[model samples]
Target: MSDDLLKRTRAVLPSWLAIYYDEPIEIERGEGRHVWTADGTRYLDFFGGILTTMTAHALPEVTKAVAEQAGKIIHSSTLYLNRPMVELAELIAGVSEIPDPKVFLTTSGTEANDAALLLASSLRRSNQVLALRNSYHGRSFSTIAITGNRSWSPTSLSPFQTYYVHGGQRYRSPFAGLSDGEFIAACVADLREVLDQSGGDVAAFIAEPIQGVGGFTHGPDGLLGAFAEVLRERGILMIADEVQTGWGRTGEHFWGWQHHGFVPDIVTFAKGVGNGLSMGGVIARAEIMDSLGANSISTFGGSPLTAAGALANLRYLLEHDLQANAARQGPVLFEGLRKVGSPIVGDVRGKGLMIGVELVRPGSTDARSADAARGGGPGEPAPEIAAAVLEATKRRGLLVGKGGLHGNVLRIAPPLTLTADEAAEGLAALVAALEECTP
Candidate 1:
């Protein structure tokens, strides 16, 4: 049945839209941390639909809210006063941490980021922008311009003149051998150089607290804070692209930027806010949010249905303190991956449920091995080994995701409600899979 569907999908869908596995499984349903294929084969879900199913599969609170809201009304354009939208915005503003915050809803992270770009460029009166190397913002025309990862950026034409800077990822970095303080200083120097060459009046500096598609990699803590101080001095706004790192997924903080020791001028979010619903938003100071002279409205941005579902999802996440759950479970999962003892596993890093296991060739003098030998360097990225491990894990009834500049990093992000037993089970399966694929 899946084969037929796969054939139809391939015939119609764009080839650029990648799917996982040799034979992609059609997920028919899900509950909690597991999903079932069309053939009723159950697999432990580790990716959580690319970290979208944030709370749990089929969460009752979100489900009920969507159903109830749909019964009354699904959408009424932003022209009317939307109660659900207002409620959700109020909640988001309360927790946004930005001073004098204002909220604008959108359908996806791409749109949210597009809105942010609009605000920054208009306010600064310049199309020049700064973005982190090895970072991804979105797929839209405006966002692809700022994306540093070439694989994701389909074109060079862009409305904004974007300058890529260093220091998003520590491993595989030119400054990888430096101490945290030294690394931050080098990155700051690099930023200043870019600013000097950028012809000045750079609009904003955008970054992910943790690079998601760059394989969940990040620099030393307070690195962005250091960058922020420099950008602020030059009147450059800081925009935190928290699409993957927001809402306590990082565990230590409700927002990933909080880890950087400063608040951003603008914060954009999506992917887990509505528990798999199509929702995204941006929060900013009223001055920036209202900078535009003309009128604008998102026809379907804060529709009744999505806003209600997102509101319920947020309430549940906070009430249950899923952020704390991530904090508790993240260490258990992180340590388990470290203890897997796979020769191919080179490095494990990230906070909370958002963890990455980078792969390398066995017996190679990679950074992990070099560090052990007091050498300290990066490994040759082993994308082939990563591919093999993906198939092996699937055969073992586990589902994980992969990404990296070299495509050699395994991304393990389960739902925040992950149980202790589930973690152990997933770890055992991962260990066995690695052993099966090991040379």
Candidate 2:
């Protein structure tokens, strides 16, 4: 059955649209933190549909709200008075830390970021932009221009005259050995040098508090705050692409950027708000959000059905204190992964529910070859190893994900409601899988 669906899907879908595993699993249905394939095989979900199922799969409140809203209306365009939209916006604005916040709803994170790019370029009146060295904002042509990773961007052309800066990945940095303060200073000095060469203040300095597609790695805690101070001096707007790092997924803060001392001029979000529904939005200070004078409306952005579902999901997340759950459960997950003692697990880091486990070349640690392996190096990122481990885990009734610049990292972002027992079970399966692929 799965094979038939895969064949049919390939017949219709674009080749560039990637799927997980060697043979794709046809997800038929989900409840809570587990999903069943077409073959009736159930697996405990670790990726949470790429972290889209924030609270959990098929959450009752979200489904009920969507059903209720759909029973009345699906969409009425952006021209009408959208009560659900307004309510959700108000809820977001209240929590958004930006001063005098305003919300502009969109259909996806990509569109939300597109809207943010439009706002920044218009308000600052310059097409020059600054982005982190390993950041990914979105897939749109405009957002892709600011993305630093070449593998994802696909094209050299850009809507903005973009410059990539350092400080996204501290692990791979030349400055990796420096202290946090010195590292921040070094990055700031580099920024100055880059700006001096450009001879202009960039329109905006866009970044992710924690880079998602760049192996889920991030720099020292205050790196962005340091950059923010410099960008602010030149009146450069700061755009926080919080698509994956928002909604208390990072645990310590409600928003990822909040881990630092700065508040961004614009924040874009998506992929979890509606608990499976398509929804996203941009939040910013009132001044920046309202800068453009021309008329604009998203025909399908703020659908009442989506808004209702998102609002209910938001309520459930807040009421359940899922952030607290993440904070508590995150350590358990981390510790278990560490104790797996697999030489493939090189580094495990991230905050809250968003964690990244970097897999390195196996046999790097050995009794006789220990020195040789250490001298031979961090071993090229082992994507094939990661792929094998992913399949092995699935065979064990556990589902996980792989990512990174070389696609060698395991991204374990379960629902915020993850339990200690579930985490332990997943960890055990992960260890078994890692061992299975160790050779």
Candidate 3:
């Protein structure tokens, strides 16, 4: 049945819409942290639908909210007074760290980012923007221009003149050998250089606290905060693209920017607030948000259904303190992966439940061996090894995701409610998979 569906899907879907695995399985349903396929095979979901199913699969609170809202009404465009939308907005604004924050909802992270670009460009009256190297913002025309990753960006034509800077990832960076303080200084210097070449008027400096599609990579802590200080001096707004790192997924902080000890001028979020609902939004200061003289509204942005569901999901996340859960379980999984002692596993990094294991060819001059001293330098990206491990893990009834500029990094982001036992089980499966794929 899945084979037939795959054929049908291939016929209709765009070829660029990448699917996972050589033998793709159609997910039939989900509950808690596990999902079943059309063949009734169950697997523990680690990637959480690319870190979108944040809280859990089929969370009852979100389900009830959606069902109840659907019975009442789904969407009543943005022109109407939507109580649920307003309530959700209020809740988001209260949590957002921006001064006098205002929220504008959208349907996805892509839309949220697009809207943010519009706001920043319009307010600053300049299309000149600064984005970190190896960043993946979105697939839209505006976002593709800012994206520095070659694999994810398909086009060069862009509305903004985006200057790609250093410091998104440390592993493959030119300054990787530097100490943390030295690395921060080098990146800050690079940012200043980029600004010098921008002819003075740059709109914003947009960045992901952790590069999601770029393989869950980030520089030293406080790197972005240091960059923020420079941008602030130049009247450039800092937009924290928290689509993957928001809603307390990072564990230690509610927002990823908090980890850096800075408050951004604008923040864009999606992927966890609604758990699995199609929801996203931008939060900014009132002055910046209201800078647009022209009227705008998202048709299905904050519809009653999505808003209600997202509200329930956010409430549950806070009440249950899943952030604490992520903080607790993240280390268990991280340490377990490190202890696996897989030669191909070059580096493992990230915060909370969002972790990445970079695969590499051991013993190569450009690659770090499993037992190599820490920060020996990033090894040669072994995308083939990553592919093999993906297949092996699938065969072992475990699901994970792969990413990075070269697709050599394994992304391991599970639902925040993941337990220690489940982490152990996943780690065991991963260990077996690595052993099977080891040369």
Candidate 1 ranges beyond 4 A from true positions: 365-376
Looking at candidate 3, the ten consecutive residues that score lowest on lDDT are: 364-373
Which residue pairs does candidate 3 place in steric collision? Answer: 367-379
Tens-place lDDT per residue, model 1, 27-141, is 9999999999989999999999888999988999999999999999998999999999999999999989999999999999999999999999999999999999999999999
Can you give the TM-score per candidate against the true fold?
A: 0.97, 0.96, 0.97
Regions of model 2 farther than 4 Å from truth = 363-377
Candidate 2 C-alpha lDDT tens digits along 234-318? 8889999999899999888889999878999999999988777899999998888889989988899979999999999998999
lDDT of 3 at 78: 94
Error of 3 at 437 (Å): 0.9
| Shift of residue 265 alpha carbon in model 3, Å | 0.4
**Tens digits of per-residue lDDT for model 3, 1-439:** 8889989998999989999999999999999999999889999999988898999999999999999999999889999999999999999998887899999999999999999999999998999989999999889899998999999888778888999999999888878778999999999999898888878799999999999999999998899999989988889999999999998888889899998878999999999888888999999999999999897777999999999999999989889999999999999888988897878988899999999999988755363433235546667889999999999999988999999999999999999999889988998898899989889
Top candidate, metric lDDT? 1
Ordered by TM-score, highest first, the candidates read 3, 1, 2
Cα lDDT for residue 7, model 3? Answer: 93
Report each candidate's C-alpha RMSD, comma-separated, in the order given.
2.1, 2.9, 2.3
User: What shift in Å separates residue 317 of candidate 2 from its native position after superposition?
Assistant: 0.7
Error of 1 at 195 (Å): 0.7
Looking at model 2, the pairs that clash are none
